[model samples]
Target: MGGPEQQVFHPNANIVRKAHCSSMEQYRQMHARSLERPDEFWGEIAEQFHWEAPVKSNFFSYNFDINKGPISIKWMEEASTNICFNLLDVNIQKGLGDKVAFYWEGNDPEDYTRVTYKKLLEHVCKFANVLKSHGVEKGDRVAIYMPMVLELVVTMLACSRIGAVHSIVFGGFSADSLAERMHDCRAKILVTADGVWRGDKLLHLKEICDTALDKCSKIGHNVEKCIVVSHLTRLSNAHTQKTPGMKPPVHKTPFTPGRDLWWDDEMKGASNFCYPTWVDAEDPLFMLYTSGSTGKPKGVLHTTAGYLLYAATTFKYVFDYHPGDTYWCTADIGWITGHTYVVYGPLANGATSVMFEGTPFYPHNGRYWEVIEKYKINLFYTAPTAIRALMKFGDEPVKKFNMSSLRVLGSVGEPINPEAWLWYYRLVGQNKCSIVDTFWQTETGGHVLTPLPGCTPMKPGSATFPFFGVQPELLDENGKIIRGPGEGYLVFSKPWPGMMRTLFGNHDRFETTYFKKFPGYYCTGDGARRDEEGYLWVTGRMDDMLNVSGHLLSTAEVESALVEHPDVAEAAVVSHPHAVKGECLYCFITPNEGVHFSTTLVAELRKKVREKIGPFASPEVVQHAPGLPKTRSGKIMRRVLRKVALNDRDVGDTSTLADEGIVEALFSNRPPEASKLLKAC
Candidate 1:
């Protein structure tokens, strides 16, 4: 019932690309053929790419049963391929070299750059040679910690060209978070930048990298070299732009003479010619991590051939991308969405993808519309959070710009709220572009459930149907499969090409976390409902996690961060309803016996969480409690805290609590008092 006024919107023939199937019947036919004859369907799709060798089978003999034995899922087992060739070389070989590959618009309007397939290939080859010169080889892991820039794209492709598995930690992550990821992967080489522009603030990325490297070295991760890109012109006097109100920082990045190298210096010495390294289909392409329920994040491992095929296929079908059309997905390279959609998918399809290194409301509220008009972007993919943020500025800013070039619109990261969905549908799309509310996760390399813009009929809040080769199911609390038209936990019953191979260095955790829950099916950890006609509506996460502004943040991770503060004895973190971010974190802390709770203490604790996790995980409400409601076994009653955070009068079943008095004590000092305290801080 929470779904937006359910209205069925069919495909608009005027906006839909002609190459895509125009009806649901064609989609159903293709889906049926994909499930019934996978080899034939996927084989035909694979033939569109340049594979070094043909795949003999779609999948090897592997059972999905977790209880019976270990689940071994492998796709394209006998094929040999290279992702760099498909993304870069193939387009160049087909005479699309001169066509624009990436139109990079920097944070400041004065800064801009464009790269063609030919130029991109040359940069990739040069970087690949640079990596080889530094002893990087196949199976070696390289760590990239950079902001949204063209160099990040080159680094990813260069790693792929040389068969090195690259792990890109988002630039916004804390040093501790970056160190943990680097240590987990034991990266041989590290790539970073001196600084990055984020609105008015310049993030000193080199300082963070230095701190992470210090920890990595201590943990026995012997990173051979660090390549630092001097990205900020303000760091040097000669290139600095003197503005009336802009004040640059005085911090200078230190360089280690032998161990560290300049990006340009290394590129200058390296030759712009390197062959793509052919790898087996099952070889790992990249490793990405997701916020796990536990304190530690899980490193999701995605393989080469299957992931590439799935990414390209979904990009082509979901957006109905054509040869000359331009596509733009405004996501950073840190997340899986950016890795799959922004880089691999669009490039593999040889589409002109916009790479904007700024926010939607940067210089103005119509920045996105301005770019759409400037580049004539045919497809615009973004998050629901961004849409909601823009909605706050009203429709006038959007009306001022021309968005006529947009043919398809997309929503990702989290489920699109009904109100935000309608605004995006009417204002940005002008009822002409089809809105694809995509639903997937970091574990799934590409979108699994979404509307094929040209084919499926879109409902405002629903992610229309499953992509080809995906079989979804709804399971009740007792693990019984719910039939049609019901609400339950979401689970996948079949193997998909883009699925994660395992959690890096923790296959046991992967098997237990995802497989052990449902035995045979992969647990999505999300609650979902299917309409009578079988359209899926993601009902948010069922775990102790919150999708705050489309970024996944775990409650346990924040709790861990809060407790790391010496004054905090214990903490309970929960999500409360938020208008814009979907959910915001609220913390209830029981200080150490003698420690006092003050506004300064609250500010320090918030900073602690920001440094320990990331800036996004900082709790909006930090309530000081004498003690948290806990059971005899010492489990904090998070539900009671959650109820208090939401100001709900009905506190469910306090009879089982070891300390019932703590509930009243906690609620008496809830967000109203906490908000006053936070405001003072």
Candidate 2:
């Protein structure tokens, strides 16, 4: 129930006066100017930042032709800059040394930590010195696998300070997943921790790192050193620990003496004065891997200067952040949201951000609201998945806290349904703060389609407008542009400063996947509709992928895992509606000619999927099918399968089906026991 008619929250007087644009008319004018004369518009904004060397030109070549080789998009290619210096040192030079940089909160309420700009710089310098002592030089890839702790931020900054590209893997990922990333990046050093507390249990992070290192070494990965941080000082020494229903390693895992070093030991005598490295603007700052349709993840590489400038500018305007205002974005550091908004974006703007170490529902459903009240957080940003998950517990948990301190609320990661957006506006915002439903991805380093909190109008389900420098286009399947008020595949017409330069080690795949689809435009892989007023409503992905609770999962990856079992002959995986998670996987498998299908086989298949990928990818439903609808060339018709999984009676045209009887067979002979199996599990 959100549209142009919804009540709007105007920016504060001070905020409006200092913003890039004050009103709707000014926003439209500035947006047009950014597109018409981007060089002049962006060059002025870039001057606000501290560049090591002046930029000669904003663009290398302005050509978006698909037939003319590759898109030659380059910005500030010859300039030199350092993101760490712009984030910390520049702020300190402006007499902001005593301002709070990060307000860290632990799982338990009693545990807390605060670091000012001066202290954060000191920590980063010391860690940079430690990394240098361990032979980590420029251009080396450093893998960071740690929980949401202060050390995580310090390590990332230290890596950037030394010109080393950091690749951060999710802490919950399995050992195989970690090894795959490490092997792909050829990481020279690995950083981890002993253990971390989640809810009432301890996750043995060091154990996972050790197991992943073993796999990495076996795969010819030459990691020179592993730096282990002691999160929990006194973990049990026993190799195995068994709880009632879960099996978690209770002990602190051991490390190799010559190749491993403790965090404290490395930082003991290190000097706290290391100069930030001067890297070319095009030098890679970090490599973040996103799930791929072909089962192997692709590392999306972002550069130093362009990504930082984009992130900082967007953070300043979108959130309308003021000095001394606390910002909290409840996202993991491993994801792009955290990398941009939580760390780089906020720090580059010199705004105080909150780092939370626990889940939203761990201690209670009210944990987020409590933090907002506890720290006087003004801007709150989080994924729509968390908002929907918390909606199930009703408004009682949210009512216990005073939410008047919140001036802006944001939804990211996935499209927010109308119901969830309404609940967030009414309950969490208390009708005082504005809600911005931002639509972007891991490839775009910053927000692409979002309403600037104070400048743009509020719309519940729609991502109102594109960011200033972004040019969005809607195109039909035949490569024809749909100008106004139409639904089509979403594409960006021009390259922006924040867009990913290339995929690590796979430039061909990057071009083939994104540009090859639409030829002249960057295909976003998602369908969308533009209203008469030019607001964008993003429908889910149009490809063979699923956005399960904001995490991208490939249907092909899940199908490949399912068919790996000996009992399965072929498999087709589809997605269906979910209440909390945006979507859940539903697998249809055809067993071998004489193989018996039973719950035992289902359990085995699930285990294989969990081992191959991560447990988050295990299908919610596994149903046996005698035959699947396919075309003449033997391609499984996923559209037909998706309709069947959703229990829709209107099955589309069967004229292209090789076997028309297969659809009837699949629907009539569907296993009744499948529902029971899903419920019991």
Model 1 lDDT per residue over 1-681, tens place? 222437888888875558486788888998888888777777778888888987764554455677888777787899899999999999898999999999998887667779999999999999999999999999999999998889999999999998999999877777878888999998999999999877665678898888888988898786889998888853344235545455655666878878889998999978999999999998988998777777688989999988988999999999989898999999888888899999999999999999978877668878988889988999999986577556656689899989988889999987775666788889999988889999999898899899998788888778879999888999987899999898778999888788898899888898988888888899999888788898887876777668888877656446656665657656778887666667888888877656788888899999987887678777889998887775422335677887888666588656435457888887778757555533443
**lDDT of all the models against the reference?**
0.82, 0.80
- How does residue 480 of candidate 2 score in lDDT? 96
Worst 10 residues of 1 by lDDT: 233-242
Number of the predicted model whose lDDT against the real structure is largest: 1
How high is the lDDT of residue 214 in model 2? 92
Off by over 4 Å in 2: 1-20, 58-64, 234-250, 544-681
In model 1, the runs with Cα more than 4 Å from the true position are 16-19, 57-61, 234-251, 544-681
Q: Pull out the clashing pairs in model 2.
A: none
Q: Can you list the residue pairs that collide in candidate 1?
A: none
